[model samples]
Target: MTSFQDKAILAEHAIRGVLPPTPLQRNVHLSEAFGADIWLKREDLSPVRSYKLRGAFNAMRKVLAGDPGKADFVCASAGNHAQGVAYMCKYFQVKGTIFMPVTTPQQKIDKTRIFGGEHIEISLVGDYFDDTLRAAQAYCADIDGHFLSPFDDEDVIEGQATVAVEIEAQLGGMPDRIILPVGGGGLSAGVRSYVGDRCALTFVEPIGGACLLAALQAGGPVDLRKVDTFADGAAVGRIGVRTFDRLRDVSLVDMIQVSEDRLCITMLEMLNIEGVVLEPAGALAIDALKDLREQIAGKQVVCVASGGNFDFERLPEVKERAQRFAGLKKYFVLRMPQRPGALKEFLGILGPEDDISRFEYLKKSARNFGSVLIGLETKRAENFDALLSKLEAAGFTYTDITDDEILAQFLI
Candidate 1:
């Protein structure tokens, strides 16, 4: 086997020929907010709008280099990874077939098709990525095509290490800390291997898909009972064996689990304030800085901006989530007396800043009262406190369901 350092350096040199190094730019907003020298490793600027292309290119090049007869490659992905593999297939002039979940957005499907051009074929199968991955593996075996894992493979991990290679070179040395957004562990593991404790490492994962944290707790990789796919790029039911092996000893204290809703706010802030778009997974590391504000203060820290393949259609949902997470929006089930002046009285109770976004009568729970579902928005989160206080003073009964995931999914 080739040495990891050798493979990573080889990837850095070769990839530089394919594309310019992604910038390591100092972020003024983030630096000021964290009271630290915050730099963003903008992998979001990569040709595939992600760092996945690094791994895909490395893995494919090695396969064809070792076995010149290899002509085809296969991979399963829901978002960035598929496009990365597709783009690399075209670059290598190798035949490729990408399997994606049927639930994948049409925009992503179109982008993947555009990247691969005539060098690839796409098959939409399964509603979930796990099912799609299985079908892809079976088809790869049947056709004798080399299966390219999005992570897990040694070459892929080595390729991802090139990210660290560039970071160190671009920064002139390792920073005081490097925060990495982890999926199946490839990027985290690769960066971990490259830094080798010279710089402190913080692994960031979406709370809904914190497979790395689960693995650390179980002493090995374990399949999660359920995974929230909101952060699709980093959401994995199980961490990869090879990748986890490298990350097995990572400290729990160094891992930051970012809630899906909380991450939505970070995504929006980057897009609106920084004018840099980031996918959910891409925002994980930057989100962690909120939790690590004290720890990273006055230190040189780097946050990996993992990807930027966000669909504009999802913008509304992202805004809703961000608002809810920040407490600027909420949902409530109110019991209203079935009388003409009841709503008017309730409306009068609302503060000047509080606005009702959604109002629907759910059902008549009693002869005199009806259950009403209400979605409220306000300029300030604290305004809800005063508004709710006034509602109670007016003899209104309401159930706050903003934080209730299951209830919101059904009722809201």
Candidate 2:
């Protein structure tokens, strides 16, 4: 049996004919910001714009090597994984049937089609990923097609380990720390298996979909009651059993849960500052840097930029989340007196830096007062405190709905 490192080395060699090793560039901006020698393992630059293709290619190559006639493959994914499998199918000239949730963005679906071209067929089934997965598995079983798991299978894990292999070669040695963004734990497991205790390892997950954190807490894999699909690529409800087995011994302290809103901030910063487009899951490792700044100060750190398959259509939503997280934007429901000058008075209360992004009177005409829905954006978070003070001094009754999730979801 090949050892984990040996399998990773083999996988790397197998894939080199088709795909080059992704760049491992030192990011001066991030390094200066964190006071560390920060290097980005640019998995986002992969042909499929994610590390998923590495595992997909490795697994398919192994399978086809074993049985030259095995030509049918199947997988279920909402985005990244579908693209990876589709690209690999096209490369290997195998017939692939990819199942994706109906809610998946047209951009992702179209990209998958482009990647697979004539070798793949896409089936839009079910409303959610779980439903789509079930459909894919059943179709695979019925058709006797090989079902490719995104992260669970050993071959996939071994394939993902090639990332570690490349990193070691590129950096000439392991960094002091490796930050991995965990979804189903394929990348994290692979990297951990290869690196072992050679360096510190940190696993990050979106707070809304912290399956690995939950698993560590429970001492086993446990399904989350709900997952926030905002970070669709990393919104897995549960960690894979095989992945959990590989990572079960990892200390829970090394796992970090990042909020979806915080992820938006990271995405925006990367795009605006670095000109880098990162999907929410891809931003996880970069966002984790904030929490590890002190620990990694003056140390060499590697953050795996997991994916860059971001849809530009979501830019507005991403900006909104980033603004909200930074406290530079807010929503409020204000009780305005039913008077001609009331609106003017409220507007006057806003600081010079404050800009009203949204304003709507909930009730156009009320007996004594009208409820006004207002969205405010300011230069700094501190601007809100002054604005609120001014509102209070002016005898305005208002409810800050900025942090009120239920109200924001219903009205904002």
Candidate 3:
């Protein structure tokens, strides 16, 4: 039997050949905020800024030990896993062929190149990961190269189990509760396999792309009809079949789906208040606390901050989402008189704290009135109530299009 203890020992040995242990620090801010002893496993601080290297390192080491002639490796990934494989290829003195979606950020591609140096060759394939994966698999088969799956392989799971082993040692024992973010289910399955009833685990998934929840509901892996890529790291369309098999019996109650916008709020809070930088997936465990407030009260809880490969270009969208979730900002369509003082009169109803972030007047269908799109932002959410009341009293006919998905998508 491939027990967790065996994998833990192997991971210890394998990881030492690559990098030092990531930090496991108690988060005072989180503890105070949630009324629990909150600890963070900072896997984001790894050399590649992710826990993927552990799995790649362990798998390559074991494979080489068994057959040294199997030197070349292949895999497809759009982000962290690609970097992990590239770095491992350099460390193991093996050739690697990495396939990535063409739409992947330039920074990620450059970082992968830096890690792999001359040992890895990267090919940009189709715009989506599914297409890229198909290309990589076919290429690997044609060349008779060892195809390294990011999570499905038994070795990868055993390697990922190392995170659980380290958590146990670093915390001095199993924590009362463990919270993890799930994408393809690899990390969650592996860690849960190792922990094995020793700790209570809560799995968090992005609401828009909850592959694990779907798989659990279906009693097997099922592809999502659509995936929202806002939480890119955790926006997997389908959980890996093997990983899902390992996680099949997980209780539905233990799974929590967090809205992408809510995650943005948590990310901003962690950055602004706690001075922590976390990608969307990295913030999952911390954000999940809201749902588990009752269960984890006064208990020791550990949250895995999975990865920190955030791109600053997305910060504006993150801020916008956070503001919307907090109710401090809203977008709406307004009907206004086309007369000269109509616009000025509408603006007069605004509270001092309410700022017009967006204002656009569309063509007037009627001679006396026009349709206007307005975005309002305020320092406090309550400011909206006062602003709305003033508008109502002023007799300005308006419709709040903020919650209208089709309209918001087109205008907001």
Candidate 4:
């Protein structure tokens, strides 16, 4: 039997001419902040702007080589995977049927169309990914087409292992530590297998979509009740069975789960400070460094920035969430007296750094005990403490609704 390393080398050779090495550049901003020699494995710089193309290309080539008559391929994805398969279909001049959820953003749909060119057909399927996946599988079975799993297949894992192959070649060797973001476990499992025990590995996952953690606790793969898809690239409801088999022994200490709101701060920081635009999933490895500061300080570290396919239209929501996580922005319901000077009196208690970003009537505008919705932004997170104290001293009654998920979903 061929060894994993031998197979990875085969994949490396298969993709050598297709994907030139994605840059493994040392990131100055990240290095300074973390007090480490931080090198970024910029998979985001790939031709498709993500590492998914690597797996898609390798898997398709292998399938065609094994069975020449297999011309039809099908896949389901809301983001990078769909774009990847579509890209390879055009490359191989093969027919591909991609199924995307109805809720997929128009920008992603258009991009997938552009990549596949004349070789691929896209079907807008169900509203959710699971529904979309089932539909794609059934359609592929009906048409006698090959179904390309997004991550689970052995060939796909080998394809993703090519990332590790490049890291070794480009960086001269593995760094002291390599941080990888886990979704369905393809990239993390592949890299972990390739690197072996030579380097320390840290896995990052969005807290809301921590399938790997759940599997570890259960001692096997299991579906999550729900997944928060903000980090859509990493929002898998379950880990791939074949992939997780390679990753089952990873310690819980080796995994870091980050909140979605907290991840937005890192995305914004990388964009604003480093001029590097990263999607939420792409920022996971870098965000994990916050917890590993003492362990990784002064050590050579590599963080995989997995994808950069971020929509600029979501910027405002990202900024708002980031601010809320940092405690620099807050929302509250204020109960004001009916008197004319009541609003003026409430404004007087605010510190100089506190600025009202939103103020509106939640009830009748001039009615006694009118309810008002107020949003405040401050220069620092601590400024809210001083402002709230003033509200207490003045006998003003208000409810801090900054972290109220239910109310936020409806009103904010």
* Top candidate, metric lDDT: 2
Give lDDT tens digits, candidate 4, residues 1-412.
9988789888988897687889999988889988999999998899888999988988899899999889999999989999999999998999999999999899999999999999999899998888999999999999999999989988888899988888888888878999999999999888888889999999999999999999999999999998999999999999999999999999999999999999999999999998999999999999999999999989999999999999999999999999999999999989887888988899899989999999988886465788889999999999988899999999888898989999988779
Residue pair clashes in candidate 1: none
Number of colliding residue pairs in model 4: 0
lDDT of 4 at 315: 92
Q: Which is the better candidate, 3 or 4, if ranked by lDDT?
A: 4
Per-residue C-alpha lDDT of model 3 across residues 34-62, encoded as one tens digit per residue: 89999999989999888888888888888
Clashes of 3: 0
Model 4 alpha-carbon drift over 4 Å, by segment: 364-367
> Which scores greater on TM-score, model 1 or model 2?
2
Tens-place lDDT per residue, model 1, 168-275, is 999999999999999999999888887897999999999899999999999999999999999989999999999999999888999999999999999989999999
lDDT-superior candidate, 2 or 3: 2
C-alpha lDDT of residue 38 in model 3: 97
Model 3 ranges with Cα > 4 A deviation: none
Worst 10 residues of 3 by lDDT: 2-11
lDDT per model vs. reference = 0.92, 0.93, 0.90, 0.92
Model 4 lDDT, residue 293, Cα: 96
lDDT of 4 at 353: 93
